[model samples]
Target: MADLSKDYMSNSADPKNIQDLTTFVQNLMQQMQDKFQQMSDQIITRIDDMGNRIDDLEKNIADLMTQAGVDEHV
Candidate 1:
């Protein structure tokens, strides 16, 4: 039977493998952060759009009230 300890020892002593693993983890974390930021930006944009639409609707209602001679302050 072939011994496997030597293989494990050799792999553990290699710094290149560790560096590669570290780089991979860093890239993954960066991608996750970027995606989170993109989603947050989208949510903020939607909220802003909804606010603008609500404002327009309120203005339209006020205009309608004025046309009908309805008192808006009542």
Candidate 2:
């Protein structure tokens, strides 16, 4: 395998640099979380629309069966 430990050893200096790095990571994580929430909201809205359409279809089917003299209770 390639020497990965050497890369981590290179940045083992200066506490201020590490603090700045932590702040950058936290900001990135927050932005990612906001984007994820937006995507989830859109998915939920689409699911609700699909559910409404399915309900409409079910009602139409029942109406058609009734018009054809088919007993839905059977």
Candidate 3:
């Protein structure tokens, strides 16, 4: 196994090496951000689905109670 950390970090100040490291970090951050956005979108969609189901259930219960002629006092 090669130790990437050891090879990337050097005492010498090489411009090319610094640029390569910076590019690599930038790419990694972009990938992470994209995945986070995807996860957030999925969560929001699921929540919306749940809310729709709850709304349907509420409507069904109200309809049933009205059909049965149940009063709030009773």
lDDT of 1 at 45: 100
Best by TM-score: 1
lDDT of each: 0.94, 0.91, 0.86
Displacement of residue 38 (Cα, Å) in model 2 is 1.3
Worst 10 residues of 3 by lDDT: 4-13
Instruction: Extract clashing residue pairs from model 3.
Output: none
Q: What is the lDDT of residue 24 in candidate 1?
A: 96
TM-scores of the candidates are 0.84, 0.71, 0.76
Q: Sort by TM-score, best first: what order?
A: 1, 3, 2
Q: Candidate 1's residue-wise lDDT over 20-53, tens digit each?
A: 8899999999999999999999999999999999
Q: lDDT tens string, model 3, 5-74?
A: 6665552357877788899999999999999999999999999999999999988988888899986456
lDDT value for model 3: 0.86
Off by over 4 Å in 2: 1-15
For model 1 the local lDDT of residue 58 reads 100
Judged by lDDT against the true structure, how good is candidate 1?
0.94
| Model 1 misplacement above 4 A | none
